[model samples]
Target: MFALEIENLSFTYPDLTPALEDVSLQIKRKKKTAILGANGSGKTTLIYHLNGIIPAQQGRVKVLGQQVDKKNMQEVRKAVGLLFDNPDNQLFSTTVFNDIAFGPRNLKLDPDTMTRRVQEALERVGIRELAERPPYCLSLGQKKRAAIAGLLAMKPRVLAFDEPFSGLDPEVADQFREILDELVEEGATLVFSTHDVNLAYGWADEVVIMKAGRVLTAGTYDLLRDGQVLKEAALPLPLLAQLFRNSHEQPRTVEEAAALVEPGSGRLKAVDSSR
Candidate 1:
C-alpha cells in the first residue's frame, strides 16, 4: 500500500506566486525516497503538504489512504512525522528528555509508557547520554538526533525528513545517513528533500527531481543512473556516475561500480596498457 500520495498537487504562497505546480507523486510503503531540487523548487512546500501542515491550496493530498483535510487532521498528523529542517524550530523543551517526551506526553500516554518510549527513542538515535543535557547546549548533530527522537516517540508510520544531512561534518553526515538507513530497513516510509546529489544517489531507493515548483522525473536508481535527471535538476551525478557515463555501464552504487569495472573497461584498460 502507498504511504502517501499527491495527485495533481499545487500550492500558492500568500504573495500569489505559485510554490508548487501540477506536482503528482507517490511514496511507497517502506521505501526510502529522496526528493531533490534547487532552492525555490517547492521541495519544502511539497513536504509540508504531505502532513497537511500546509493544505493542498489546490490539489489532492492523501496519507495512508485517507485524503488530507480538516476531518483527517488528527489522524494525518499522527501517522506522518515531520522532522523539521531546523532542529531549533522543533526543540523547545527545557531538557533533552523533556523534549523527547513532549510528543507522547501530549498524547496522554501513561507515565511508564511515555518514559519507555522516550528512552527507546533516544537510544535509537544514539543519543542516550545526552538525555539530561539542555537541548541548547548539545552539538548541532546531537540536536538533530534529539529532533528525530521526538518524532520517533510519536510513533509515526511515515517519516518525512527535511534536509536530514545539512550542516554537519562529513563523519557526522555519514552517521546520520546510517541511522536513516536503519529506520528504512525497519519499515518506515521515508521521504527526505536534499540538495546533495551524491548522498541521495547513495541512500535513496527512488529519486524524484523537482524544479520551478514541479516534478521533473521520478524513477528507480537504474533510471537515474546517467546524469540526465541530475542535469535537469541542475545537479551533478556522483563520481561513480561520471565513470559509468563515460563507460556506458549501469553501476548505480559504489559497490556496484567496483564489481562492474572489468579489467578491460576504459580506465582499467588504460592502466593495464600503461603497466
Candidate 2:
C-alpha cells in the first residue's frame, strides 16, 4: 500500500505566488524516497501538506488510506513525523528529555508509557546520555539528534526529513544514513529532501526531481543518468554516472565505478568495447 498519495496537488502563498502546481505522486510503504530540488522548489511546502501543517489549496492528500482534513489532522500528524531542516526550529523545550517527551505527552500516554517512549527514542537516536542536557548547550549535531528523538518518540509510521544531511559532518551523516536504513529495515516509510545529487543517487530507491514548483521527473536512480532531465532540474549528473555513461555501463555507486576503473590500467580497460 502507498504510504502517501498526492493527486493534482497545488498550493500558492497568501500573496498568490504558486508553490506547487498540479503535483502528483505516490510514495510506497517501507521504502526510501528522495525529493531533490533547488531552493524554493516546493520540497518543503509539499512535506508540510503531508502532515497537514499547511492546508492544501487544491487537490487531495491522503496519508496511508485516510484523506487529510481538519477532523483527521491529529491522526495524520501522529502517523507522519516531519523533521525540519533546522533543528533549532523543532527543539523548543529546555531539556532534551522534555523535548523528546512532548509529542507523547500531548497524546496523554500514561506516565510510565510516556517515560518508556521518551527513553527509547533517545536511545534509538544515540542521545540517551544527553537526556538531561539543555538543548541550547548541545552541539549542532546533538541538537539534530534530539530533534529526531522527539519525532521517534511519537512512533510515527512515516518519517520525513527536510535537508537532513545538511551541515552534518561525514561521520554524523553516515550515522544518520545507517539510522535511516535501519528504519526502512524495520518497515518504516522514509522520505527526505536534499540538494545533494550524489547522495540521492547512491541512497534513494526512488527519486523525485522538482523545479519551479513542479515535478520534473520521478523514478529510480537511473533518472540521474538522463542528462536532459538533470539539466532541466538544474542539477548536474552524478559524477560516477557521468564518467561511466559513455561506456554503456552506468554505475550508480562508488564501488561500482571502482570496479570499472583501475589507476594503473587504461581508462576504458575495464569496459568491454564490443557491445
Candidate 3:
C-alpha cells in the first residue's frame, strides 16, 4: 500500500492566493520521494496535506489507506511525522528532553517506554549531550536536530519533511542523510521537499516537480533526463548531469562522475555527440 495518496487536492491561502490546484500524488511504501519546484510553487502546501496539517479543501488525502479527517487526526499523526522547514515552529518545550518526551507522554506510554523512546530519539539525532539544555539556548542547527528528535520519539511509519537540510552543516547534513537511509532500511517511507537539485537527483527514488501550484510531472530519475520538464519547473539540471553532458550515461553523484573521468586527464575522452 502507498504511504500517502492525494487526489484532486486543492488549497488556497487566507489571503485568497491559490496554493495547490488539483494536485494528485501517491508515495509508495518504503520509498523515497522528493518534491521540487521554485518558490511559491506550493511544495510546502502540498506536504502539509500529507499529515493533515492542512485540512482537505476540495479533494481526498489518505495516509496509509486511512482517510485523514478530524475523526482520526490523532491516529494519522501517530503514523506520519512531519518536520517543518523552520525548527522554531516545531520546538516549544523548555528542555530538549521534554520536547522529545512530549509525544510519548501524550500517548501515556509507560515510564520506562517513554524514557527509552526519548533516549533513542536523542541518540538518533546525535543530541544526547544537549538533552537537559533549553531549546532557546541552542543554535539553529541544534534546534533542527532537537525538532527531529521529537518526531523520532513517535516512531512514525512515514516522515514528511520540508527543506530538511536547510539549517544543517555539511557534516550534520550527512548525518541526517544517514538517518534517513537507516529509516528506509527499517521500512519507513520518506517524502521531503527540497530546492537542491543535486540532492534530489542522487537521493530520491521518485521525484515530483511542481509549477504554479500544480504538478507538472513526476517519475523516476529517468524523468529528469528530459531537460524540458526541469526547465518548465524553473529548476536547473543537476550539476553532475550538466558536467557529464551525455544524458545517456549521466552520473547521479560527484563520485559517480569521477569514476567516468580518469584522474589527471585533460578532458573527458568521451564526448556527447548531441552536445
Alpha-carbon TM-score of each model against the true structure: 0.91, 0.95, 0.96
* Backbone clashes counted, model 3: 0
* Per-residue lDDT over 1-275 for candidate 1, one digit per residue giving the tens place of the 0 to 100 score: 69988999988899998999999998888998989888888889999888889988788988998999999898888899998888999999999999999989989999999999999999999999999999998888999999999999998989998898899898988888788788778888999999877777777888888989999988875545657777887877776666656464555567766665555643442222222
Question: Which tens-of-lDDT digit does each residue in 2-63 have in candidate 3?
Answer: 89999999999999999999999999889889998889999999989988989999999999
* Candidate 3 TM-score, C-alpha based: 0.96
Q: Which scores greater on TM-score, model 1 or model 3? A: 3
Instruction: Give me the candidate number with maximum lDDT.
Output: 2
Supply candidate 2's per-residue lDDT for 256.
76
Best by TM-score: 3
Each candidate's lDDT (Cα)?
Answer: 0.85, 0.91, 0.90
The alpha-carbon deviation from the true structure for residue 137 of candidate 2, after best TM-score superposition, in angstroms, is 2.0
Ranking by TM-score: 3, 2, 1
Distance from true location, Cα of 178 in model 3, Å: 0.9
